[model samples]
Target: MTRRPTQLLLATLVLTVTVGGCSNQNHTEAPPPSGSPPAPPTTQGQFTLPPVSPITPTSANAAPTGIPPAVAPPQVDAAPFNDPLRVTTAWMRQFCQTDFMEPINENLSRAATYATPAATAADITRGDTTQSYQQMQQQKLATRCDQVEASINPEAPATPSMVYVQVSAARTQLADGRPFQRLPLASTRRVVRGGDGRWLVDSAVDAG
Candidate 1:
């Protein structure tokens, strides 16, 4: 049966291979000394190579002379991915919950995590695709928020603060209608150190 491309991609991603010696036999017949005469030809003009010793027969139908072991080179220590200024998911959550924008914020700091500049630009350009439907949902959410906030006072330190944010897909929805159900969305984020010795978010991806 034919396998899926995604399965192949996943297998490639997970495999950790190392370069090592092969099992093929190679006769390292030393060449004639530099600038020396060429080797003499044998019968029928065929330059014959030295013979490899045949293995002795054993009682158990195995060779008495075992096959040469494949040698592995000395392993070296690998370097680490040691970047201190890395972004954390907590930072994205904090920013999302605290920041308030009615229409859409296209210039937010979350656009950098993409592997290419085009993808980063797309994340920004596509921000407003769901703005209309979100406006309608926002009103309902606002009412729910008011009721919830009134029932649970914010002044008390023990009270948990809950923020509501709706994330949608690629297609745009009307201000009073529902969004499409099956639009693909993905996000990746990374933090790198700033000049001031602090970790700052440097990259974000909305799609793979």
Candidate 2:
């Protein structure tokens, strides 16, 4: 009877030890195999993005490399008769005619627009003397004369404010319908800027 009880107690102890060994083996984890790929990392709260390259700022008017920039066009003056050559040429064309039939006062007033006060006075004095001689010749010939054609050639010299004009004039006799005379004249004219920003003839000298 004593041997039977001892055998039963030994069997219970062996079963308890075997069950504990099995429980410990099941709870433990085995190591991964050699050369195996690692598992992907798990995200916890928020995802982190990869870094990006920075961009550089550029000017609004900047031109690209190896390219030329755009340029504006040049401005041009639009004033009328603003140059010495133009004003001198205009004066010679108007007063170089042989037909002095217009009134002396009207002619002098018109000439003053192109010439200075002193120059206009001097020119009128010379014109009155010449007209008296021409009138006497017309009366002696018993014929009236009128200007038929005129030509003007202007030359600009090294001086910027001066110009020389050459005039070729022809007159015809009204009675006989024949050519009356030819008057070739050369004059030096100086121009100046007026108060109103216009070019005006300041003085003139008849060279012929």
Worst 10 residues of 1 by lDDT: 141-150
Best by TM-score: 2
| TM-scores for the candidates | 0.25, 0.41
lDDT of 1 by residue, 1-208 (tens): 9889999887766563311122224436677789998766663223222233443544322322221221222123121112211122222222232112333442233323311254345445654446643543343211000000001113422211121112222211111121111112223443343344443333442342
User: lDDT of all predictions, in order shown?
Assistant: 0.30, 0.46
What is the model-wide C-alpha lDDT for candidate 1? Answer: 0.30
Q: Pairing residues by index, what is the TM-score of model 1?
A: 0.25
Clashing pairs for model 1 are 85-191, 85-192, 85-193, 86-191, 87-191, 112-203, 112-204, 113-203, 113-204, 132-175
